[model samples]
Target: MLTLYRPGTGWLHRMPAGPKLLLILSVVLVVSLLPAHWSTAAIAALVAIVGYTVSGLGPGLRGIRELGHQMFSLRWIMVITLVSQLIFMGPEPAVANTARVTAAIVLAALLSLTTRVTALLDAIERGLRPLERLGLDAARCALLLTVTISTIPVLGRRAAEVRDAQRARGARNNPQTFVIPFLIVALKHADELGDALTARGVR
Candidate 1:
């Protein structure tokens, strides 16, 4: 489920998946080319506000909060990015780079919040179909993208479940106690998914 989507009848939600995806891609391309950090920060805030407004306050806030939690989990990567930019490019560029990245992440989260997974996959497949002329498997690529996106939350929850089970067994709160069970659960999930796909005649 990825937990980002909020069911709604707002303009953003009602918008067709293909157009919305195109809009998101346009925004990402524009943001990537922008040089001013303040501009990117402003754009990010605006997009976030739009997400909240379209979500009807309650659901919007919940969606934003969920997205924020996901962002918080990436603290280490953000820190490393900022530090690297600061050391090599100076404070202004560091801030700009960080702002651009944050804006991109928020935009993506907004897209996921407003769009259904199935709709998103359809849009992705349609977009990729153009590449099928070059021998790419658009359907398979879309399915792969969907699987990757959906599996993230699944893996996160699996890790948490493993951690809690270890705690219940009076085990120490350490990576060593958690990693093996997590890996086992992951492998089991993969096997089941593979079997299901095979049964469905998916190559």
Candidate 2:
């Protein structure tokens, strides 16, 4: 989901976006591909501390909470993943997998919180420039990424609106009761987005 860059003069704010992005990718890869250990949790804690320090106390706490909420939204998937891993690979692998994933997510959130959206987009485009030799349009790829990130929060808000309406009508707050209406709202939102983009002459 897209989040605004909080104006700040912190070290992270002044850091070059390209290097920050590269560091984020490197950290996520290390945490994800390496065997997990208690050290992994330490890494996560360290990243979190840096994120908070860079963001400064007030905005930093808010940013971390926002990132935490996104991870919280995936609770069911984490639960299922842990349970399946526990059944097949035992507790150790389960814990490792979950911890690594959580750390990767936290690191990504830190990157987003610290970097400006335009800077992030420029960095992504620069990274993808090599693919232009393969006939890929780097600008288009960056635009798509921008739209995708921005649309996530829009769709999430639509879902929340649908849920609240259903609740007000006394519908049970279960997936069975919510999914259909939520889907309908999402489709409608997508249609509106498409029309707006078309009107703006975006391909």
Candidate 3:
């Protein structure tokens, strides 16, 4: 499995997961509230660029380069979002939507690259502890959030692998050929993950 967490001594790496997650949420909400104009897209793109700069500064550009590769892994999804939004909402809104989505993706990839999965889960559980009396399962809720964050890269890789394998087999690059196999691969991974989690008594 490809791990998104990159070990680093950068400030982002040193920052606690809880505040990092909150920062991500705050940026996302801010971006979403902006008017769907070209300026909105520009501001969102600037935010993502700034995030990359901070990730690399003081630690050299290495962190930024590594994070960029992780971000690039999700390019297919980004492209699809761009095309679909363009078709449904036209160019202006499409640009804004895609920029916002890209910003969100950058924030998410940043968190996963810097913070350990366990640390993320622990932070989530601790935050949710106060609601445990309301019958919430902090451990499970934390696990769910951790899994959701971590799955982004894994699924991206899976789709790429499936597409490559089909191409190697001389299959035409059509939506049907790619999508079906990708879903099968994703489902298989889901089952394996479930079994692993169950074995660890995470259920």
Better of 1 and 3 by lDDT: 3
Task: Put down candidate 3 lDDT per residue, 1-203, tens digits, no spaces.
Answer: 23578687888888899998888778777887888899988998788777878774346676567546655666778889989999999999999988888777766777887888888989999999999999998899888888887787778768778877988999997876777788899899899888878987876
lDDT of 1 by residue, 1-203 (tens): 34457777767788898898788768767777887565666765566555555544244366566556545544444666789999998887787787677666666656776788889889889989999999999988987876655565455556666767887999997766666788999898888878866885788
In candidate 2, the residue pairs with backbone N, CA or C atoms under 3 Å apart (3 or more residues apart, or in different chains) clash, namely none
Ten-residue segment with the worst summed lDDT in candidate 3?
Answer: 55-64
Cα error, residue 188 of model 2, in Å, equals: 5.8
Ranking by TM-score: 3, 2, 1
Give lDDT per model, in order: 0.70, 0.67, 0.80
- Give RMSD to native, each candidate: 4.7, 4.2, 2.7
Identify the runs in model 3 with alpha carbons over 4 angstroms from their true place.
Answer: 57-59, 163-177
> Which residue segments of model 1 deviate by more than 4 Å?
1-3, 36-39, 54-73, 147-203
**TM-score, one value per model:** 0.65, 0.65, 0.84
Task: Pick the TM-score winner.
Answer: 3
For residue 190, model 1's alpha carbon misses the true position, in angstroms, by 8.3
* Candidate 2 lDDT score relative to the true structure: 0.67
